[model samples]
Target: MSELLNNSHRRKEVLMKLLMRLHEGESPDTLRTELAETLKGIPYAEVLQVEQEMISLGMPAEEVTQLCDAHSSVLSGLVDVGDAKAAPAGHPVDVFQQENKAILMTISQVRQELNTAIQSSGEDFKKSVIALRTHFNHLSDVDKHYKRKEFLVFPVLERQGLTAPPEVMWGKHDLIREQIKGIHEILLNPELTAEELQPVVDLVIEPALYALAEMVTKEEEILFPMCMDSFSENDWAQVHEHTLEYGFCIVDPVGNWKPTHTAETTAAKVESEVQSGHFQLPSGRLSAAEVQAIFNSVPFDMTFVDNEDKVKYFTQGTERIFSRNRAILGRNVLHCHPPASSNIVERILEDFRSGREERAAFWINMRGKMIHIEYFALRDEEQNYLGCLEVSQNVTRYRELEGEQRILSYGEKKSD
Candidate 1:
């Protein structure tokens, strides 16, 4: 038995047979016991190879995806990782793992809230539900994590001829995303009763949470280890460089990772060229540095969402009412706000796109200051909708002003 397990070809053959049995509707519990008795520990790489082989040998990728969670459950705690390479503190894999840690922490809190909601009644139950909503909102940040993998890591894996796993994993990502959206819809009801919440907890909430946690397991046990083995240092460095474009999930990366062999990345080179050139417009031209300075020098915060609803740009002012980071670049604007308010954002975008609304404005008291926020529909000379611009400012002083001040009073103190 030891010799058979040690032989790579025989080991994979055994794994393939067992997985086929699993595909044929054998109980995971039964198969798990049999696998333990036969092959004490299957290498993670062999499992992946068997999956790839199955796909190459005529099993549809969709079937593999359907069985993904089932097989992962069976192989849970049974895959060997003693020989997996360790990631350095600031490496992209390390950052991904850290984000998983943060995600797991949030999941733990969500479970605690779930338990509390199950055990409580009335306002206490409502409070627990609200807490769950907040945690899930944080969980929604995992979209950024998944996006980084999809946009950065998956392409490299495909180039390496390892395509099936990424496809299967991306399918799983879409499933989790839809589940999270459903969970948000359920949690959005402010007056949900404990009795009403129990069914949701069992049917929708628990399943979603399980899917989330299981994906983390798949990532750490199989995906990250395989990527660590397959990707070159330069590949990792490139991934680390663009990670911020989609943003981090729940937590930021701890340290910066740069390849010792390469001095400049493609993004940096492009940025350098832009900085050295002028940005030409119909009526005027400004250097890149000057344009950036002018934007930052403005008093209010400005964010531009492109026609595709992706966040294209944001200005960094000295006193920004809301925070902005490079991580939000190219992200769907809908995902930027809390789920409860997403409908409002969607309505505004729809109205702007349809030309039914040119502008929308609102004001609120936040943190002892009056904040004014407005959204404007940007259009071309031909009246074609281009995008949407969001402007926000603290208008407390403006609201309190009794008389207009001239330029001569710019540096003068107002009378008490």
Candidate 2:
């Protein structure tokens, strides 16, 4: 009886070690294959013990991330020789991977053109540089994409004692952001002669492209696989809920994820219980009256027009960069503008309705302030015209912004 008990304990311990390797993504091959069928029912505590032992043995987190992938592949293979489950279409991981792939592809395209422009010097060179800047600015949206992942995805991983991947990914993100800024500076200076372009390419653009490619690989192989392992259906369900708030890089999410029965019930209860009168900020609760007062205190004027091209609402922000009043509400949007521009506004509205144009933008000097204005068409389900939104902000300071201002200061918090 003593011998049997000792042997049973030994197998259990061995089985747990194998499970941890699988979770870390390492493959012990035959050991994993043998235990795969038997490991399903093991409690999470036993699984965690194996991971703890690995850390105690001094294996790094990165090595663990790599090994965990291998382990997952092996066990996944045992389930079916060639039929491992693919990520479902539009799974957050799948969609995020697709976006990352596109970003790398765009970076590659831009780099090639930048290189070609460097080899030639003439009138065409300035055109090429301008084109390069346009393409590079598109990458700004990628920052938004990465930030969404940091806020929405990293928190869940942290709950599982995973911090290494987020730290590494964020570090890479900062590097890419810096490279992009360096490229902007190089483009702005007239010193970028053909001879100077090579250094810019090597120092700024090449590193940026390589970083972009490395990030793609890291996401596909390491970061995403770990997310798949560490997240539950419910966790992903939460990520799907919040991803749209930040938007995407190149792709619009195909369909919005709706809450299931339990989630919907919980959401309904919370919404019902919470008062809508105030927004609770980190500083304090802002009442609805206070919210209006805050908006009315901004430097820029604000307006909203529904799909029908009818003026619906406008903020009474102080220091009105463009004058707006309560009288504009419920007015035909075209009539709100000067008659000389009414036809142009009508054409813009028509194009918006037909989905031919997403935005109508213009900028001009007004009262010594550079006012940048844009109109965006809004559409709802079934792609019906919902209305247009017009936002006009004084961009005198915006156009003059040179280097980054990362830390928020007094004026930085304002967004119109």
Best by lDDT: 1
Give candidate 1's total backbone clashes. Answer: 0
lDDT of 2 by residue, 22-115 (tens): 5654546766666766544332223333444565566665555434434343434332212223456777777686678768778877977887
User: Which regions of candidate 1 deviate over 4 angstroms?
Assistant: 1-6, 119-131, 188-192, 241-245, 263-268, 325-335, 338-341, 399-416
Stretches of candidate 2 off by over 4 Å are: 1-85, 259-261, 264-416
Candidate 2 residue-wise lDDT at 261: 70
TM-score (all chains, Cα) for each model: 0.85, 0.49
Candidate 1 lDDT over residue span 12-73, tens digit each: 89889999999999999998998888889988888878888889999988998888888888
Worst 10 residues of 1 by lDDT: 258-267
Position 412, candidate 2: lDDT: 65
Poorest lDDT segment (10 consecutive residues) of candidate 2: 76-85
TM-score of 1: 0.85
**Deviation in Å, model 2, residue 261 alpha carbon:** 5.3
